[model samples]
Target: MEKPFSDYWKEYLNIQNAPCGQVGDTNEDTLNLLKNSDVVCSVRFEYRNCRTRIPVLMKMEDGYKAIYPHLSAYPKESEAQLMKINIQIAQSAGVHITSNEIIYLNKEYIRKDYLDLNEFLLRSDHLFNRRNKPSKTIDECMEQYDFDLDEWIDTVQTLLDSPEFTLDRSKKCTTGRRCSYYDDCFDESKLPDDSILFLTTSSHKLQAYANGIRRISDLEPEDIEGFKLQYAQYMASKHGIFYDKVALKIWTSMIQYPISYLDFEWDTFAIPPYENMKAFDVLCFQYSLHIEDVNHNLSHHDFFDTADCREKFILSLLETIPKKGSILVYNMEGAEKLRLKQLGEQFPKYKEQLDQICDRMIDLSKPFECGLFYDNRMRGHYSLKKVLPVFTDEYSYHQLSIQNGLNAVFTYRTFDSALPEQKQVIRQELSNYCKMDTFAEYVIFHGLEKYLKEDDVNA
Candidate 1:
């Protein structure tokens, strides 16, 4: 059986004073054993330009020799200068040096295997040694001080004291990517006990709530009017907090709709995965649609889990969805329309059909994105995952094994690897998560509709 990397590293360290190139090896016996091996060969040389030492690997070929430079080889000129410097070092050490500065004089030696390791370790002794070595970078320092269970528990307890430690309130975190604890340090339960985020009125906007305003009804009507009615910065002096019930009436009227609630999951690419493809194509992988009927009842349609199957998926979606509905989506430009255009290019045969979907796409998110509907829970960010929790007692994906699209993609990709029984559970979980997304959209639409109808009655 092969040893794990840790075991191999420990064993390597036990060897004493092995050779010029073998790191962690301290024994001369181990060095001789390595030298006698037919499959491996190594040598050490000093470079003068930077006063660096490097190891080269040598391997045996049919009747000739080949040299593998260390991974740490510097600029071409630096290597040349170092080779010259190595010869001078060897001469000073009372070793006979050839014109080509061949020490140990292995005429037929070749280099192979562990070339990168040889270069990394042999060229710079600073990493494993302290002499002439600079301290590691912050990232490297983090690796060095790997925390244990006790240390982790202490840190978690410390974060629990701060309200800003919660996932939604992360903007208040002082360290921007600079802290070593960025990934491992966070406490989800540290959100304020009485959050003002649920309030619908504009006085409890994200900023107002942050400034210690916790309820919609508490603010004077002027505060709501300045922000909601005139879309003015109500917090500013003179312009002040003004709430106009008349303007609020008109603002709420735009909420009427043959509302189509939409959601999509997509695959983003670093490199184009296909010909004529650009980086960052939102390859639409799944979508959910929930529409309110003329009778005011809601109906839903959804697509999920495919690969190289996007073309047929788009065609089916175009046929199934209505052309002239108020297509409401949490983040329309980002999720629905962006993917539609990308798929359109791939299936030019249905370009007109796809464009039609884009034209009727009315974003439910516009009110939020334009700051018309601000929630303190969102902490200045408008994500449906955050917004969905404001109205209903339900969370969009609380029960699912995978919480968001990233986790969804990762789960979908590995679904086939599991045994049949395990796969069944995962498949059910994925379906449940996606279904909840559309259902949450339905809830938001209903809430908005109710708000509008009440405003119409008051008007």
Candidate 2:
């Protein structure tokens, strides 16, 4: 595992082929261990094929190492060139292996019983035996890692660079849901406002980052659109080229057919609340649907402050929403669609109607997700909170009673348990927050249309 190849596998492929012992317990112990040998060989299985042991040869007490095949009959120097070289190197110096006896004639490799770091920790009860307690924060961990996050980032970037590897833009990053680094690396704000990720790329966002374009400003929408007009046009346009201001204008101006802006807030309790439900039952409690008749005048209908009436409330929501109108929601791809699908599954009798409702659902988040719209003030974030701020000076979550969905849901859950005075205050807060979501959508829709129509707006 000499310099290049040792780093090659470890950094690029995360494949470690090294001895299974801790190095340098004490300088004296390490010196004693290496004194009898000038050379050492270690073998460890590669993760992809656990059955195969990769042999690594190292100069004892030195970092220099190599990986040569293991076998019987030390080849004569007159024959087999690579083997002869290895044998000469081995014979001249004292060779050390797992077994004290290193037979010069026959080298053997044994299949290993393997355990990963996590599995080893769990088996030793180091992970699970700990009591629930406050843990070190990011700053603390950073201090332990030499307080050089830039170095770690450089290491990761260097490892990520590759001409052969690319992203599959058509598919979602499957590991995102489970990875601990998901938020740290792939959070919405980390991407560029005009990144190929927001538009269309053949590889994932990280790959794009490694390719020297960490932000949305790095993309060319015209080039992307030229390649694939339908889905990837937004990616190709460097100056927002493919964004059809006229098409967006047409959609926004069609405020007829009794328009509605819809939003829902739900909670998943660790313990089941309803019958036949296991732990982590997602209960949809609050729904705010703001409707406008043909005149574009707005009135809102809401369902909230219910704990025991989930089924009854859902039925009420179904009745409140009109069948034909466009149903607007933020991030419907993840939030609205998942909720509706779950609702349909829970109520088989109304599955067809629920599916139909989903069919008419219009995602208000399209512009942000597509990178057709961006605001410098947002700092490359498209969350509802960030997007809503750019729309109107009159609107804000800061002055509201409930500023976020999580807090709103928590308040709704406890509203009934509060005294009469607290109940009124909380109910008003919940109402105000939910109303703001719909109102923000209304403002954001108009803002996007305005942006699209503006001649000077950047891509």
Candidate 3:
């Protein structure tokens, strides 16, 4: 007496079109009440033997297709094993699933309008379909990977049976992410000043550790496969901080009278929120500029917007920055210059001016990155956060409400639905955080100059 699965899907589509709820809200309870609902979403299953639980499982109408949604930027390497285990669990529950599908979010979905679930599914470009089709079958994938479900289960059992498990710190395992306990496990603070881990761009970490070359001072040039930066860092660590005075002076001398230290904070939405913005297009919502004039007077300018403020941000930036000045930015190669180029392309009217800004832009991280300056406290990183603390305790980001770029992005994204008071607090926090970034650059520039002067005095 039940209606077909297609009928339920048609009803679900109709419900989705209704404007009763907010854009992102899905009436889960209403969907559950529908008859002939074969598309089981978020079905939680627990395996008693392993004491493990799978939080989400999508069972299609055919009853043989199982789908798992992976949300991370990079897929987990253990995806196949995880899917196989899920299959086993489903089979035990009398669901005979023959094929598995990974419904991954496409990086290209620009959310210009309210997310339409049906449209999202129907759009070929919205999701990466890893379904068993004519091109690649589940059986073929299993065969290629030589997947044995029993062997995988035994491996899991062995892990579970272990009395006390500790992560292996013998070698750096590339999981594309740092573990939560990374600091506790590695304890870089406890490491020697001349630890081999400080060797710049060295890939022989495991080899060095294995061969008892734990310290940079203990290493010969050959130990790190003759990497110039590694040897330079090793030498610098052995001595005090490396200060290439002549090189530093040459680099800093090129700066025009007024120096503008610039920093930008932006967010990239997987779905484009606005018309002009494409999927994955960066929305630069905020910027900070610290200007030090020819008269040695310092001034600050900044902007923050919750809405589409790209044009305003760019125009404000142009106005704030002086016509003739060296624009210093930390890691210009990675962030500032690239952003300027992207902006120039996006807004052609200001392309010439943006190009001019790009020309004047100087990467402040170059001195540290190129080994012209190296400090033991830098801990193998030339990031503004890492480098700033090394120079002076006076300017520290630890006290700020929003410390990192990622946090800023997340905070800005929540501004839409936040309470008025909360929104004000977020705006203030974002401004403070961004101001600190530009201010830190100014401080670092002065620090470098001071270091150069001191080296001259000592000489």
Candidate 4:
């Protein structure tokens, strides 16, 4: 549905809330409307047999500026580079544009980003057409975009007339992401815990898998680079389990009289829900902390709210968390510690207090991640849920309505829109989920300590 230039300009000024319109396949409609409005929604451009619709065509006082809006907070480097290619491609098709820019929707409301396409030219790959030799300018590269219309038509015809579809396992595979047909292609359950394909941080695992190196035991020393964790995985497969007692002992010894097992559940907004928030900024709505004293006595503390909970959340934590103990969190850098630091940064008054909390915080994942402990059931994954199941079936997230952090946040996001009864149910589910996280932390922390005391050599 194409709209008049007035509607598009009103949308730019936020004067009217209009439904997102579409770009017509016909070029003349867009071409005529481009100048009448301050902002044009989509301008269709055709180059060779290939075509694309530039998301936004802003009418500058001089000429025109092309804008490509990215839905994600920060788009991939390739995608950003592709935006420049698209503009150059448009220029090649005689849609002369003075400048081009990429807009992150969540950010563009207030923030202005200036992009230098020249800085990206050397690395930009062909968007629609491949070239045998590299081109010096973006325009030069786009000029070489010659799509074989007949070749594509012929390929489509052959596929349509094909009698049977056959699977070819011999073809090179992309294991970077698991697609819908992944399970049908590879029986992941049959792979051993220490399969060469599961080698930690190795990009060439597909090459190893293709060469018939199924298990880590089958891999020769020269086949893989000697990464610290990779060797630990290899040794774990051979020696039954990998237990770096010295490292475990050092880590365990860091725990003080009172230990706080902390877990946080936060919501990330594409648009700023509150003041002083950047795009995709986290708003911590809930947290669970389980403090265990020297006597092994456990005390649980938690915070939850539907509105701006930052101030109250920190106040509750500062008061609840013991002054002198190692605060345990699954991934300190990524989660709890980062949250605390951000909170301190956001609220400067609490900077000292939050910094103190961060100083005491320790990542409980060190043992498993640093190769101090390993179990075959872990399956090369060290997430709280994955690692928790390895210790005992007594605790499982499968029993909960809200199983993961993502689920909890998603449920939380809908709380305002939900009916009263639905809101109550959501609250209960989120509370239970957050409570379970800290409790799981408590269980896992003790489980590690017990494993150490029970070990004859380590004890």
Q: Who wins the TM-score comparison?
A: 3
Residue-level lDDT of model 3, residues 1-459, one tens digit each, is 024333333343343232221223223432342223434444434344542233223345665555544433223334556666666765665556666655333344434445443433331112222442224444444444556556767988888899977767644443456677777666778887668866666677757776888878787656666754565577677885777778889999988869999999988754445654443568788999988999989999898886778788889988889999899999987687888887886788998999999999999988888877888778787899998987899879999999999999888889888999999999999999999999999888989999998888998
lDDT by residue for model 1 over 23-81, one digit each (tens)? 44333433354356422224332322122232322223431121223212121222334
Off by over 4 Å in 1: 1-258, 375-379, 394-396, 455-459
Rank order (by lDDT, best first)? 4, 3, 2, 1
TM-score to true structure, per model: 0.52, 0.50, 0.79, 0.77
| lDDT of model 2, residue 144 | 39
Q: Write the per-residue lDDT of candidate 4 for residues 1-459, one digit (tens) a residue.
A: 024434433444453532222554545555556545666665676655456777666667766776554434343444435555566566665566766554433333321242221221121222222332322434443344555444765776777799966654432454456466856877879877778766777766667787877877677766657666676777777775676767787888998879999999888765445656555668898988888998999988888897778999999988888999888899889988998887886789999999999998889888888767887667777889978886779979999999988888788889988999998999889988998888888888788877778885654
Residue 16 of model 1 has an lDDT of: 26
**Sort by TM-score, top down from the best:** 3, 4, 1, 2
Q: Which whole-number lDDT from 0 to 100 does residue 401 have in model 3?
A: 90
Write candidate 2's Cα lDDT for 1-459 as tens digits: 014323332332233543332332332333344454443233321211111222344453433244333122232222223322333333323333221111111112111242122211111101111232224322232233323334544666666685554333323444335455445545666545555555333444456555776545455443333323323233333443345565566666654467688888888743334543323446777788888776778888998746656667668878998877788889987786777786676667877888888888888887666555555545444688988877787889998978999898778878777999998898888888988898888888767766765754664
Candidate 3 is scored at a TM of 0.79
User: How many angstroms is residue 298 displaced in model 3 relative to the true structure, after the best TM-score fit?
Assistant: 1.3
Cα lDDT for residue 418, candidate 4: 97
Scored against the true structure, residue 143 in model 2 reaches a CA lDDT of 32
Name the Cα RMSD for model 1: 14.5
Greater lDDT among 2 and 3 belongs to: 3
Tell me the lDDT of model 1 at 317. 85
Residue 426 deviation, candidate 3, in Å? 3.1
